[model samples]
Target chain A: NAGVTQTPKFRVLKTGQSMTLLCAQDMNHEYMYWYRQDPGMGLRLIHYSVGEGTTAKGEVPDGYNVSRLKKQNFLLGLESAAPSQTSVYFCATRQGGAKNIQYFGAGTRLSVL
Target chain B: QQQVKQSPQSLIVQKGGIPIINCAYENTAFDYFPWYQQFPGKGPALLIAIRPDVSEKKEGRFTISFNKSAKQFSLHIMDSQPGDSATYFCAAENSGGGADGLTFGKGTHLIIQP
Candidate 1:
């Protein structure tokens, strides 16, 4: 299985631009998460999905909207990109609960002008 | 917004030396703790993990030392090698099957020189 994979390995965007970052997992995991990692800062959760069709806000969710139309896909969208959003974004998924281990995707680097 | 706190933002070690990274959490509900290792231009991979029920867990050259009462945990790399050089992160998740989603530490940059 591919485990977890994120699309658009890298992107450059201007202010007020809208784009979507896609995350997919083949593990059939019930939990999926999106996080952004900035230099000197650890990954911060942006949005998460507990299951297909259910989404929750995380520590850093502003300016981002998420949709989990299918269990295998979780999408992160930026309505109006900002410079502050320039960072490395990673997507992860876990089987379920604390006992289940989490798997990660390579990551996508985004630049918001 | 961080729930888990980690220290020693960076470290340098010689080959065969032992490197330790520490982390602590404020949420008492956290029961599951795990460590992730990341390399340049790569995703963070699961290195090792432990639960509050146990004080320590080891796998090969990597070990996880946990203290439930202390609300702290640490990752130790024995006989450090340059190949082990990377970024290490400590995380904690609460006791239930639901909140197990990790709250990660800031991360530590480890460098092992040959």
Candidate 2:
């Protein structure tokens, strides 16, 4: 089964351009998160959704927006991309229970010039 | 402010050697700590994890040593091999607040030399 899948494996955008990253999970998890990984910066949370139709801000949610309109899909949107937004973005999901393990997707590499 | 701090931005070790990565957190509410391994062009995967109540937990060649008093924890890879080279991350979550998300460290890039 495909655990977590992220679309647009790679992308390049000019400054002020807009784009959307999609994350899909087949594990029927209740929580989904968006994070960006940078050199020496690890992975910082961008936004998250607890369940369908619910979203919340994360550590680095300034330049991004997210929607969880469906149970299996979470979308992260970049209204106006910036150079600083260039990084490898990851999508993760976790089953709601006592176990706190998070499953991640391959990742999406975005470069904003 | 960074809630979790990881040391040694990069490390290199010979084959069959032991490579250790350390992480410390400031939040006492954090009860769950986990380590993730990531290969090039892949997402980070859970390596091993530990709770504050346990002093150590071992799985295969991976081990997690937790020191609750010091708010510190570490990952020790025994018999390291070239295939083990990857970026490792330490993360913490406050389960008390519900599993909202995790606070991740800056990450440790490890290279195992053959």
Candidate 3:
């Protein structure tokens, strides 16, 4: 059912370059999130949307932006890519209600030179 | 401050052995605890979970032991196999707050030697 899908599984960008990562889900989930995973560091939430048209900052929201224009899609944008931004990004979705389980995408590996 | 702290960055265990991963949370309000397993080139998947009301929950070879009063939880993999080798993450959330996403710990790398 393609629970969660992320486009551009791999990308390389130079400093100051911009890019957008697309995440799509068919599960009709009401919440979606963006997280970055680095070595020795577990996933950290960058941004999240509770529903379409609503977004909020998580633990680490700097250097990135997110838009949930559609109920089934969440997009993460990097306005200015930096080497520190290089990490594996994951998109996850959860159903409505408290304590819902999150389903994640395979992930997008980004390398900013 | 890190809300959830996971220990032993890495572990090695022989096949058929049991590997236990521990996590402690500083926030007492957190009511939901879950463990995720991630393999190379893949996303983390829910392996097991537990609620504050329960002391332990088990499914197959994976189990979650929760200690609400102590603000600690742990994942135990019984009869570990080589296929069970993966990076495991422990996460916490105050489910009472529906919109808040999970707070994850630094993940543990488990290697099951064959």
Candidate 4:
């Protein structure tokens, strides 16, 4: 079903470089989220979109931005990548309703040098 | 701050032993609790979940024991195998559902020795 797909499985970025990670879901879900996973930190929310054209900041949204121009896609952008920003990024989506189970993508590994 | 707190940052057990990972949350509004398992390079996948109304939920060898009053919950893996070695995370969400995203605990690295 390809529930959620993330592009650029791995990438290396020099400090101050900008990049965007793409996330696409075919489930027609109403909610999408971006999260980063780091050692001993688990997963921290970067940003999220409740629906098309709507976005909100999460716990750790300081250096990241997100766009959800379309219902099936959510993009995470790093304005200026930093060494501390290096981590594994994950995209997730959940079907709207009473159900809250979130499905996740494989993940994108980012290394900022 | 860290809304959800998980214990035993890492654990090691025999192949057939049982490993339990616990998590406690301060948010009283949180009504849903879930456990996710992730391998070395993969995203976290839902393992099992429980609601406040239920104290326990079981799926095969994995089970979730929830304590609504204490705002604590745990994941128990029975008859663990070496293949079960991976990182586990406990998360919670209020009635806000998916749009609110999930508050996760640090995570537990489990290693089932062969």
Residues B1-114, candidate 1: write the lDDT tens digits: 467989889999999999999998988887778899999988888899897878899999999988877888999999899999999999887657453278889899999999
lDDT of 2: 0.94
Question: Per-residue CA lDDT of candidate 4, range A1-113, in tens?
Answer: 16899999999999999999999999999999999999999899889888999999888899898999999999999999999999999999987767788899999999999
- TM (B chain), model 4: 0.96
Q: On TM-score, who's better, 3 or 4?
A: 3
For candidate 1, give the docking quality class from DockQ. Answer: medium
- Measured against the native two-chain assembly using Cα atoms, what DockQ does each of the candidate structures obtain, in the order listed? 0.60, 0.71, 0.73, 0.71
For every candidate in turn, the CA RMSD to the true structure comes to 1.5, 1.1, 1.1, 1.3
lDDT digits (tens) for residues B15-38 of candidate 2: 999999999999999989999999
- Output the worst ten-in-a-row residue range by lDDT, candidate 4 chain B: B93-102
Residue-level lDDT of model 4, residues B1-114, one tens digit each, is: 899999999999999999999999999989889899988878889999898999999999999999888889999999999999999999999866446767999999999999
For residues A1-113, write the lDDT of model 2, one tens digit per residue: 15899999999999999999999999999999999999988899898888999999988899899999998999999999999999999999998877699999999999999
Between the candidate structures 3 and 4, which one is better when assessed by DockQ? 3
Which scores higher on DockQ, 2 or 3?
3
User: Which pairs of residues collide in model 4?
Assistant: none
Tell me the RMSD of model 3 versus the true structure.
1.1
Error of 2 at A19 (Å): 0.9
